[model samples]
Target: MILLLLLLLPAPALSAPGRTRATIPGDVPVVVEANHLLRKGEGTLVASGAVLVTRGNDTLRAHQAWYDPRSGELRAEGGETEARVMARVDEGEGPLAIEAGQVTRLGSGRLRASGAVHLTRGQDTLQAHEAEYDPASGEVQAWGGESRARVTARLAGETPLTVEAGRVTRVAAGVVRAFEGVVVTSDEETLRAEQAEYDPQGGELTATGAVTLEAPQGRVQGERVVYNLRTRVIAGGEVAAAVPAPDPEADVTYHLRGQSIRGAWKGEPGSGLPQEIVLERGRFTTCESPRPHFSVDAREIVLRPGQRVVGKGVGVSLFGTRLLTLPRIAVDLSGEKDAPGLFPRLSLGQPDTVGLRSDWRGTLPLGGAASGYAVLSARHLFRIGAGIDRFGSVPFGLRAGYKEEASSRFVSGLTLTVLPAFTFYLPAAWSPDGPLQVGLERMPPSARLYSGDIEGERWAPGRRYRLIASGCAGRFSEHPTEVTANRLSFSGALEVRPFGVLPRVQVGGALRGRVGYYSTGTRYGVVSPELSLYWEPSRRDRLRLDWRHQIARGTTPFFFDRIDAERSLVLEWRNRTPRRALALKAELDADNGGLYAWEIGYSRRLECLQPGIVLSQRGGDFGIGFTLEIPGLSTGF
Candidate 1:
């Protein structure tokens, strides 16, 4: 039995060949089997036929075995079942299984397996032609067959990652290191490097030595890459990424060459546009040939796609010569000249005005969602503005300064032309709050005029039902409009989602109330109910309808206002395809039985710009406007 047991399971850690001391656990029941067994001493065993052994949490099986009492050596040979030598070690995690054509236990915490060597644990596996294991250190070193052997691991339910190299080793638990022509592939992304290290337990992966990664985004090459699964961040040094056009049909792709790249993302590297991406010592270009035709080199660059992209210490070069050098900006990379060099903006239908009726604008990138934009209006109308982050998504922001509309140049005064004011957003998740503005002489002339007015609002968080309450109180001008009015007004709205059915039909409504009073005497109060309906039959088509009503005193009014009797309706339709979008809007005022207004717009993407036209009839004036956009660039407010 001792000889048979030795053939099936090797002696515990201490019993291996060269150890000075062996601490064998007596609690483990060793079961052994064989056609024949011979024991020279407690350490000597020889067995043949159906040999198997079981040690605490480990087992070995073979058809034949030989043991030396002096050296404490064991040898297992194949027969039936290929008599394949197998080792199954359970170290808390299922088992670390090793199988090979031949197995040798050298007794001093050393083991060797040759021929079809394979190791497997859970969803992870390693295969090679030969391998070695150190029982004392629990390290596995493997060599490939005629072709390269590989390691496969599964992480976070994403996809199975496969790694291969000329040589592989597992010196520590849950950590694997591969050297020479190392390649790791996950989904469609492939990373190649001279060496790679993966730690499944730590959720960390890294590669070094001319690392190159290929994904849908394009191709990236760098000196090293370190990715942490917990942080969802991929960082690399000396990186160059070629990101192709998001649309597969587009012929252009941007090559982002940088000293380093660090970003947080969920996609399999490159398939999904990335946000919060930072690049240092970077240059961006569209050329893919051996040499770039043009490039924008910058000291530092930050990008939050669909939000903003900023490059600082920038130089735009044509071929090799620097064409434009600027400190920073939202540089347009659409491959078209920016409407070709300072074209004057001319506007008609304006009364004789001293300043250019509109403003010429330019923006320079400073940081995330923050930029310095200078509007070149007349000296009197020119203004500079900046804001930090996006209040809804990121943290911190400056709404805007209280800039009053410009009166004519002759009559314009600091008090009447502009008010000194600013607004800040409070840090919050989900809802926008902590917004308050104070304007001194910067009041809206159309609102009966106000001075020292402060307004704020709060909202209840939820989509099933949304509620917003807002109020404003300030001094009304002792002027004509509302002279006797020391004004205070409050408004609140509660919206509910009535249904969440499929087919993408949405139904919603809001009950709103408004109340206003003047210290002098006049007051107005009303409650209105609004209904909205939206239909999205497909990704490209949508329709929406909105209905609202307003009510005032009746012939014989009651003390409290009831639901508005006058009705108003607005209907809109939108259809969008790959390159074109069409929209129509119509409004009807049933209170007075009149048409409020209607507008139609069509936009199409063109080679150089997305030109759009708008025609509208409101009140009694007919207006037409044209829009031009450089594709793949930021366009509006």
Candidate 2:
């Protein structure tokens, strides 16, 4: 019975130079084949002459191999004239293939390969002199040994990448770690560091130790950097970068240094430079001088290329000297030749009555929905005036001190706007020269409502008519003690452009009627008709004439509601171009001296500067003003 069982067994094991199968008690069965096979000490098998070994999903082929069934370990070596030993292991993350001069499988399920090792899985490849592979986790680690062969890998993802380092390790399916002189290259950016961790699946590369990233747009260097391959956003600490101009035609670059930085690219994801970047404890400048001609240092800075730069807790320096410190500041970089951003302005002039005067205007963002502007003037006549305006949903404006030859304690107004042409204003004024005491003076709170025209397109095509209705109620006075009346008034104005034949010439007319009732039992009615002729001879020149006639049927005690002018005519000529502007205006009014008043103003716009002059004559009183403005820095308030 024993002899028959022996004969029934496979003949290959018994035959020399054939295949043998070794079954372990708790492991997968091992199969070995070669031209020559021999039994060594303690269940150890030696195979030579084109040895092939298979255990589970792992397959290895070499010229000679040694397998110990007791320990479940295998080692293979290549022959002198033959190719190196090669092994392949099938795992969850594709098949791992390794080629080396010698390969060893330890009992702990780890494979060690040396001597010009080359590993591949899917589209990823690794080259090193020594490497270790974990079949269960599909992790491959390569390092330089005595031969000092650097490890290199090529990863094929959305962006093809190449990594070279002294040591490289595959931590996960798409995660790689590199150390010691690491360089990662892709189409969009190149990165260098002493150590880096890259996850191609997540499109993130984190590099540390004097890291540097260079892209087509600019370059960044820092102690550490984490870059998104997909978004092309770079974030790091102790960062310094040179960002190119957002305008492609411009050849300017900005330098930034910060404790920490985070930014993003604009326009399309892959193309274009960074549109916005933010830095903490940052210094930013466009000057390339070693010390920089001008720079801004701030607690926090936000840079929007080609638009503007905003800074908080900022200190501005010029020529290494600190010039100013501000809570917040914004600088515009739109490259507009004429319409510059808000800047502090100082002008010296002489008014009709006020002596030598100096005026200053500036704009400030009040944060949130409100931005505030102020105009302050000081006169030699011991009169100081200030006007402040806030723009937002509920705009508030205030003028204090003497203005227009009138001494005003304060004149303040608040406007409430409702959608679709409804506006209400709480108008109040208190003047020392008025009949009323120094208290709250309601200058007739008013409400204005309009329709039949688009808000910003009143002069656009298609709109031919507009209707405006306004009402006010309260005390009214043009001067102190001129009238003692509490007035309620309602007015309506209708404007129509009935002519459509001449596109370049616009002939429009408006009729306005007003009715008022006074608390002192005085009622008045007034009607006003106005005609306007506007001719645009060219894109840069226009001529306009306006004739207004007013008639009164009844009179009110309040001069504020009384219309004194029975007839008025105004003619204006304006010439405007990209580089210069000229304006001429003449007015004739009856019932108010019947004097013909005229004014002429001209301004020339240079690349970065503008100069203007205005001369006016009103009833023998002549006035003149000369102004010099920096186009990008003048606030023209």
Candidate 3:
């Protein structure tokens, strides 16, 4: 009961194993008994018996007890039995067993237990003849055992991140401050220090006084360190670090003995490899001798971890001989990628037969999360007819776009494009073969377009229902003809998600009403309804099928344009998680006279670039194309 009361109090969820062996209802009546009972008349109630208190997953037992509620004091005495006074508290992973010959509680939070006092939580154990505890602050102090105080804890992770210390303090919930001869260890790493403090919740650790951390990648010894567990960012002073080459076969560890080091490391999440790092006021070398055969004394050195070693204000020595000097240089440590700079693209028949296009792309982060992003790209296709006289912009020019979303509820986007199209003809002098083809030419002019959209979605009462409203507007203009037009469209949709109707299956359907109007006074109304079903065929494969039907009504001349109702069924399937991902999509029963189209694509992701192949068929046209994703900010080669 005492253990349950302590857990029920505001504290971290350190419950042992989360199982209630035997429980007593809190609202039930309580009966106290003993061979002899006495009341001090005004203050204390004393009883003697084989006492037992139980609540939920916690229990306390003793041979005798006394309580002074007005003074907020409780005491329990143990007789010469096999089990003395003890309290067992269960936390999800295991039970904490605390015992003492005599136990005393002051107020609601303070406790003093003496005579062979011991505490055990999970695999960790602490022993002391005397101990004091403050439950509100999770502070514990102990002395006795004819020796000194000590603490040990098991850290659960990919490896065993356990620690042992001469003395430990719960500085605060989720935080532990330990002193005197502390040793932290894991399967692949170990850190020995004189003192250390750590926050288990944040995975942050700080240590001081002759600290040395060793792992598979390298080793570091320093006077102090502040390391973030999640980000793998570390800052240490009076530091000596050994960074290994990305390739193990190199059999060389680069040593950076420096005054300080700061960097955000990159490994496979928790692999403990420093993918990136930086050091200040250091001497770096590849030699493993007691004294480096040669080293570079630098003001700063940045490790593009595994990729390159960049240095500034660097001086090199060959066996203590001042051999060379470099103001700045970046040594290549890794190979190249389809980079972010200008890349020459070759297409078989895009804008023309065997066309060459120059493409440049870049991406930048606007802020936090995945939504605030701005991407810019420019591409120019080089095509030829003979005797080109006019100097004009190339085909498919430039685009700048940005998008942001507030989670899944609201989204906003804007994009501007420089779209180019031209028809070419040979001049009289250029058409040497025939005069009939001299004047045959068609020019459609150039155009630019801008578009924006805003959307908001909300759930109605139950999670199965959703309401969405969105609006979009766009404008385009022809340069030479000065012909301009604008369009605006708004839609409202109600979605029904009855996903769990079948096990391991998800299904949804929605009805949408849309209205679109153009600046030229042309208007269209659409009644579109869609139904979709998705199933997980395997642990790593998914298939989705959808049926979409649209009813469109508008006025138009048959000779100018024909407005037809459209209905289509689409199906898509993909692998859930793979080194290389593949997807297939098919559309059936479409608007342009009952035709079907589909596409299949495969993609492979690299650190700097992703390459893809797409095979698509639309109506009667089929195409197979190769593409490269070079749209992100470079991680500096």
Give lDDT per model, in order. 0.56, 0.64, 0.54
Tell me which of candidates 2 and 3 scores higher on lDDT. Answer: 2
Candidates 1 and 3 compared: the better one by lDDT is: 1
Q: After superposition, how far is residue 540 of candidate 1 from its true place, in Å?
A: 4.0
Provide the lDDT at 339 for model 2. 30
Winning candidate number (lDDT): 2
Write the residue-wise lDDT of candidate 2 on 571-611 in tens digits.
Answer: 89988654576889988775564545787888885433457
Stretches of model 3 off by over 4 angstroms after superposition:
1-49, 53-59, 63-73, 77-84, 88-97, 100-102, 107-109, 114-131, 142-149, 155-160, 246-250, 270-274, 288-290, 304-307, 332-637
Q: How close is candidate 3 to the true structure, as a TM-score?
A: 0.42
Better of 1 and 3 by TM-score: 1
What TM-score does structure 2 among the candidates reach? 0.54
- Arrange candidates by lDDT, descending: 2, 1, 3
Candidate 3 lDDT over 1-637, as tens digits, reads 1110121221122223422122212343223344455677875767666555443455556787776757656687797774577765554434556687988767664777778776665444555567666655555665543565455556454333666676655532545666778888756777889988877667778989999888776788899977766666778998988877665643446778888998874455856655677889887766555565466778998876455676778887645776668675454454233222222333332212233333222222342111011222222222211111132321111222211111110111111222221222122121224422221121111111112221222332334454544444444343222444564556566667546567768888888776766678887777778888988878668899888888878742111112222677888997623235578998776655453567787766453244567676654445455554322211111
Report the Cα RMSD per candidate: 11.9, 13.4, 20.1
Give residue 602's error in model 2 in angstroms: 24
